[model samples]
Target: MELSSLKFYNVIVLGFAFMLMFTGFQTCGMVEQTVLKSYRNDSIVNGTVTYNGDGYTSLAIIYVVFAFANWLAPSVVSVLGNKFSMVAGGITYTLYLSSFIKPITATLYIGSVLIGFGAADKQRIPLYIGLTSVCALGTALLLILRSHPIQKLEVGDPEEDQPSEEEEETSDEAAMLNDSLDVTHRLSWKLFLTRDMMILSITFFYTGLELTFFSGVYSTCVGATERFGEDSDKLVGLTGIMIGVGEILGGALFGIFGKKTIRYGRDPIVLMGGAIHMVTFLLIFLNIPDLAPLNKTPDSAYITPNTYLAVACGFLLGFADACFNTQCYSIIGTSYPDNSAPAFALFKFEQSLAAAIGFAYSSHLVLKWQLLILVIFAVAGVVAFFVVERKVRSRAEPSGSSYRNI
Candidate 1:
């Protein structure tokens, strides 16, 4: 007997993703830094650039697009064919990968529109909030649904025969009632009510905020500090080095300790990852200099051990990001089999919405409070940790059907 079609598809989807995601993910680290550095001189507040309704017209636009993406992801999947959706998303990402956004008025606006429009083609995001968000959203949408050509079919035994429409209706209705899902209501909306997914979703909001700060404030630290120099782009590029190193370490750790992590499943891993995330963030926040000149000075002495520590912490942060994501996905897949696609979709939504809000919030906070914003953001990370354990972990379970079941 041959391998099942479902198994084949799974291999193709995940295998291709595992292979290509690196190129996409590694590219993103640098792109994010560049975008953040673009606003170096234009930072309205501290090192942040909160997009108010007017001041951040471009960020504002992108925020709306992301929100729209959240709303559309679940609802719009069937409307676009998988191939078309993939093509659209590819085109859109290519634009971002090539052009991205800048501090300037013109390019940023164009980039936002392109990114938003391209991102809207498909739905559902992935385990993490970064590259996963980019590819997962579209991949989930396509993966969730299936339709085989008539020729692929073979006759089945009587016991395995298809159920009658009445039986299906009754089953669907009963399932809906049992899950408290209203059959008449929008399917996607109800899908959002998964408690465990919500926990991750809430944390994503914090993730977005953290990333916004990371991109902008990280550059800020390097920029105003005497060490990195005026070329913020080059300083920001250091993120790639740290992320690359961390990814290599993460792979090695996964290779050595894979079974141990899986034996406990993702909860402990998520918890540990969350702790690492919170601590690294705290370390980064604590290190930010309170008083610094806006312009460069001859003494430029910020590149002390603190900068090296920050770099090391950055590597840990990236590792934490990867670990939490991988574990979370494994958990969702095992726990909520039926709702896995929806789970991931909601995950992306939270990340996107959070980033949109976080960018604006951090911008404002950094301007008014400086290090205080990063400090509180670190607190938010802690809160995010508890929220997952208390609110999400308890509820994650063997509910929802796999796409095949549906």
Candidate 2:
């Protein structure tokens, strides 16, 4: 359908924005975890490195900084506005990416910290810079567009005459009181203890953990296995590409068909994703070799990754990831519209904490055990999803309100 036929701002512009932002940030992320981290860690593992101690330390720093940065993001966004906040974040990302070009221990650590700081906001800085840089030319195209959306305050418009000193003072006091209430009421232990929060927290933690597996562990596995012989680095990068493709497709599919499946509730979608992930983990456990140094002999054949299977697993993991993540966001937004800011902030905080923990221990875990752990978590996440959905339905039924799809 034409852009005019659809809701341009909500459907088209927002979709394009998400795609652009995703491509910029996710591409950098995929490369960082899969290709760059592999190269860094492989060197350390082989005893050929002096700087960048095992890469996990750097990741830990990034996530740790990110966890605390979430608290500051809202204030930053309020001050900078969405466009400038994105631009600011992009600058940090560019700095982080540039450090990789001449990665020393100092630069790597600094870059990681910068990325973490930028990531506290909705869009990390470096990715936004890349996305916006590319889309600069598209601004000319926007000049020809005619749509303009305006937001008006719900309260009646202000009078032309200035307010008296007493009225102004009262208004200022009221505004301060409202702001205090907004901050205090936005977050609460009661809300945090809700079923939806529990499910979202568990699933988001998995999201961070799975990301670590892909970026740190999985890439290392491919490299150590000598999956592409002399070209394993290239292959690892390619695997990341497959996963990115899968994520894009999965996101698009959900965007298109999510409403149709809403009648069945979010748990089914989450379960489907978890099932896909479990299968992928099983295949990985069975097929992919460990990250340990291999001893190949003339009599012994090299156990390389099956090209088809590797690609398939990557795609499926990414797709399943999208299912869990998007649905979590949808649930939080719809369930607690008033409390969404802190709810999502807490979500990001937990995600960063999990990622930090996962990355800190990633280098120590065996491939099989890692996969097994993921499978278990996936199962648990599905069960949690079901519980949340049922609780929501029960609550809604008592209120004579029907649960709606994301």
On lDDT, the leading prediction is 2
Q: In candidate 2, what are the lDDT values of residues 192-243, reduced to their tens digit?
A: 6775787667777887788777655565555445444565545556777778
Top-scoring candidate (TM-score): 2
lDDT of 1 by residue, 1-406 (tens): 2347865775666556544443453445334423333334345687566532222334445655866575554233334554556545545544443333223445556766665620110110221244545544444444443445323326664454344755776557545543532332345466566554555555555555555544444544444454433443354457556755765676556434666555544455656666776677566546544332122223333334255665676687667766655554554465557666656655566666765665555434432254455446545554554565544344543444232211
- How much lDDT does candidate 1 score? 0.49
* Candidate 1 residue-wise lDDT at 74: 29
Task: Give per-model TM-scores.
Answer: 0.60, 0.76
Segments of candidate 1 deviating more than 4 angstroms = 1-64, 73-80, 97-104, 117-188, 191-200, 214-220, 229-233, 247-259, 290-306, 367-406
Q: lDDT per prediction?
A: 0.49, 0.64
lDDT of 2: 0.64
